[model samples]
Target: MTNILFVCTGNTCRSPMAQAIMQHRSEWNVQSAGIFAGEGADASQGTKEVLHAKGIPFLHQSQPVTDSLLEWADLVLTMTQNHRDLLKQQYQAATNKIYALKEYIDPDYEQAWTELKEAYAQLEDQKLVGKEMQADVIRKINKLEKKVQNVDISDPFGGNIMTYQKTYEELDNYLAQLVKKMENENR
Candidate 1:
């Protein structure tokens, strides 16, 4: 089973929407967290309204991204490349598993993985193998991943209901595409 973890600045907005969208649309296991710890982050009313409009049920409390969660996730799909970079820097070992959601769909991920292995092998050859170099390689891989073409889902935090609705629609569409891709990959 592919385990997916969605991340954003705060659990209050984008990530939560992604979590709910994925849960409803995909067969893969999914969860979400924030870069910053927010204890008891209930779903924002705007988020709720938007999901409700689409007939998707969601109720989420914000949780800080933890080391354990990182370890558990087979795939970490963040909202932005910066989020992926920051998390990989903090947890260098799992860099291979983390990706921006858009980047996850790219055909170039295989090439990125190849480059990462080569970078690590070079480090091993130089006897300079360390977590720092691992982290650096991860950063480079994530940069390459983000080079994959994708329209980022805009953050609708603190926006009006219309903005939330628009975001919801966009996320739902992406989630549908993602679900199909994941299913095909599984098959």
Candidate 2:
């Protein structure tokens, strides 16, 4: 199973919502963390209310992101680009598998995947390609990657209950879509 790690600032808000949503929804193994060390983090009342409204079970434990979690994750999905940047800079070795959660939910996934496959094949071609051609191909693939990237999900950390509920809805929706994609890929 693919192991997914969702991250946010405090773990009380965004990351917990994502963790709960993805854990129950996706076929993949899902976990969550906060950039800051949350020693006594419990789910906020707003968070709890929203989850209870949706009938999502709550398991409370607040842990800061650790090297072990980074190493264990197959993919790390941050709530925002800033969070991704922070994680990448701190854990450069794991940058290869990190992304923003909404970043992968693009409408042009098929086209983007096709281009990525072609780029990988070019890199592996038995016949040697000239250095310039290889560089050009690499640049093109990177551009395509940006085009298909998911937009960073917003943080509703200090917002009211309505805001938390809205955020929960968005998280749940995207996670359900992710689960569907995983199922199709496995089939």
- Highest lDDT scorer: 2
Write model 2 residue lDDT over 88-150, tens digit each, in one string.
999999999887777666557658878988887877783546888888888987887776555
Instruction: Report the C-alpha lDDT of model 1 over 1-187, residue by residue, as the tens digit.
Output: 8888998888888899999988887677888999995889798889998888878898899998999999889998888878888999999999998888766765665676677667657656765568897677667756754554343667898999999888887777767777888788778
> Which regions of candidate 2 deviate over 4 angstroms?
107-150
Pairs clashing within candidate 1:
41-62
Instruction: Count backbone overlaps in model 1.
Output: 1
Q: What lDDT would each prediction earn against the true structure?
A: 0.81, 0.82
Q: Estimate each model's TM-score.
A: 0.76, 0.75
Which ten-residue region of model 2 has the weakest summed lDDT? 101-110
RMSD of 2: 6.7
